[model samples]
Target chain A: QTAATPAPAETWLPTLQVDTPQQGFDLAIVMARRAVKTTQPDVAVLKAQRPHYAGDAARLIDVSGVAAAWFATIAAANGYWRD
Target chain B: QTAATPAPAETWLPTLQVDTPQQGFDLAIVMARRAVKTTQPDVAVLKAQRPHYAGDAARLIDVSGVAAAWFATIAAANGYWRD
Candidate 1:
């Protein structure tokens, strides 16, 4: 009898269950939040940084552009705007 | 006085508010979800596509990689992994 194959090693981050494009995007956000939480556990520091960004229009635009690109990919995956 | 310049035409999409790196990332996720919902509002169609991706390892990896890149940007913005 052939030997049974061993299960693959676990990934550092397991694939999140997503039933729709919305879920997929939500998972991505969760992952990003987790990354930040893991790296910077201090709430005070996070709060301190908040005001600095409130009026930082340039950074705001940059971040939004990043989001737009990321969303574009998710939209494509869901076949949105497809001819 | 010079006539007040008309307010710049609104962008097609407005920037979301974010107080921290985590919030910024969360906003990205929200935008992505919105894009999908706006373009494809039918829940049934989204459900039908789920099975196709359940075992789509390649696509899963691709999506995760995209998330990783996105999270990395957020991390950098928050000074994570910085020397």
Candidate 2:
């Protein structure tokens, strides 16, 4: 039986739930209700934030890019990256 | 004094640390060591899990897309989304 291992990094991130079974992609469940309720949201600013409100939308496109690099190194060590 | 507000969504996602000032984009800091140390990483499987590491990298592209739609709605209610 699989040992009761420590919670994964994703588990630590309560907001972002990685639902591989359902959507297959990681799900980032944000708490907008709390944020809107207390801090007060700015429609104009938030709206203006746009698809890539933070900056270059492309930057966020590849969540696994940085991670893939590390994954490759791991593959090489364990002899997985080879074709 | 400012109110001691509850932690934001990002705060909950300990894995993905958002560094706005540093890179101007949200930083998704995953724990590779823990993932690697345990379960024994499969270089092939992990490497094959490249680009998207799931399916289409494009899906992960717009982290703010889904969030933006909701953000704008709030803007309308509180008058933040309007141009």
Indicate which candidate wins on lDDT.
1
Q: Which docking band does candidate 2 fall into?
A: incorrect
lDDT of 1 by residue, B1-83 (tens): 34687776546445443344445455444554455567998989867865453233332323333445554454444443222
Give each model a TM-score.
0.32, 0.19
Q: What tens-digit string does per-residue lDDT give for candidate 2 at B1-83?
A: 33687555344323332322111111211222233324656777656644342223243333223333333232233222112
lDDT of 2 at A34: 21
Residue pairs of candidate 1 with colliding backbone atoms? none
What local lDDT does model 1 show for residue A9? 38
TM-scores computed on chain B for all candidates: 0.47, 0.27
Interface RMSD of 1: 16.4
What DockQ score does model 2 reach against the true complex?
0.04
DockQ of candidate model 1:
0.02
The numbered model that scores best in TM-score is 1
Question: What local lDDT score does residue A74 receive in model 1, on the 0 to 100 scale?
Answer: 40
